[model samples]
Target: MITLSETSLDVQQAIQTATRLKAGAVNVFVGTVRDNAKGKAVLRLEYEAYEPMAIAEIKKIVEAAAAKWPLQGWAISHRVGVLQPGEAAVVVAVSTPHRADSFAACEYIIDTLKETVPIWKKEVLEDGEEWISAHP
Candidate 1:
C-alpha cells in the first residue's frame, strides 16, 4: 500500500498491511513532527507535494526495495497538509522472512523516500515559517 493522505496517519493499518504469515519479522518506521528544529521552537508543520510525481517515485522505491530484499509485504503512508508537533508525518512498514532483511528494507525505504520523493516540508515556528528541504 502507498498513499498520500490529508488526514492523520494510520500507523497500525500500515503495520497490519505489512504483516505476513510467512514473515519472521515486520519492521515499522514512523516519522513525526518535532517541537523544535535548530534553535527555533516549532509550532507546526505543513507539507506539500507534486502528487503524481511523488507517488511514482515511491513506487520506484518500493520496487527497488523489493528487488533488494525478500519482502513479503509492504505499506507506506505519508501525510500532507498542516500537522502539529508529535503528529506522524510518515509511516513505513515491511515484512520479510528474516529480521535483518525486514530492518534493512524498512530503513532503505524511509531513507530513500526522504531523499528521492517530491514531498516538501515547511516548518512553522514561533517567529515564522521556512521550507526545510524543498524536496523530500
Candidate 2:
C-alpha cells in the first residue's frame, strides 16, 4: 500500500498492512518533524508534494525492494501539509520471512523514497523559513 495523506500519519495502520501470517518479521520506520535543524529552532514543517508522482515513485521503490528481498507485504504512508515537532512525517513498514530481509527492505524503501519521490519540505524556523532538498 502507498499513500500521500494530508492528515496525520497512522503508523499502526501501516504496520497492520505489512503484517501477515506467513511473515516472521516486521520492520517499521517512522520519520518525525524534528525540533531543530542546522542549529536553528524549527517551529514547524510544511510538506507539499506532486501527489500522483510521489505515490508512483513510492510504489516503484516498494516493488524494487520486494524483488530484491523476500518480502511478503509492505506499506508506506507520507504526510503532507504543516506538522509540528514529534508528528510523524512518514511511515514505512515491511514484512518478510526473516528479520534481515525485513530490515533491509524497509531501509531501502525509505532511502529510495527520499531520493526519488517528488516531495518537498519547508522548515519554518523561529527566524525564517527555507525550502530544503528532500535527500540528505
Candidate 3:
C-alpha cells in the first residue's frame, strides 16, 4: 500500500498492513521532524507534494524493492501540511521471510523514495524558512 496524507501518519497502521504470518521479520522506518538543523533552531516543517506523481513514484520504489528482495508485504505513508518537531512525516514498513531481506528492502525503499518522490519540505526556523529537497 502507498499513500500521501495531509494528516498525521499512523505508524502502527503501516506496520499492521505490512505484517504477514509467513514473514519472519518486519522492518519499519519512521521519519520525524527535528528541533534543529545545521546549527539552527527549527520551529516546524511544512510539506507539499504533487500528490499523484509522488504516490506513483513511491509505488515504483516499492515494486522495485520487492523484485530485488524476498518481501512478503509492504506499506508506505507520507504526511503533508504543517508538522511540529517530533511528529512523524513518513513511515515505511516491510516484511520478509528473513531479517536481512526485510532490513535491506526497507532501507532501499526509503532511500529511493527520497531521491525519486516529488515531495517538497520547508524548514521553518527561528531565523527564517528555507525550502529544501526533503527532510531527513
Best-fitting candidate, scored by lDDT: 1
Question: Each candidate: what lDDT?
Answer: 0.95, 0.92, 0.92
| Regions more than 4 Å wrong, model 1 | 134-136
lDDT of 2 by residue, 16-73 (tens): 9999999999999999999999998999999999998888888788779978998898
- In angstroms, give how far residue 130 of model 1 lies from its true place: 0.8
lDDT of 3 by residue, 83-134 (tens): 9999999999999999999999999999999888999899999999999874
Alpha-carbon deviation at 4 in model 1, angstroms: 0.3
CA deviation > 4 Å runs, candidate 2? none
lDDT tens readout by residue for model 1, 14-42: 99999999999999999999999888899
- Model 3 earns a TM-score of 0.96
lDDT of 1 at 47: 96
Model 1: how far residue 13 lies from native, Å:
0.5
Note each model's CA RMSD in angstroms: 1.5, 0.9, 1.5
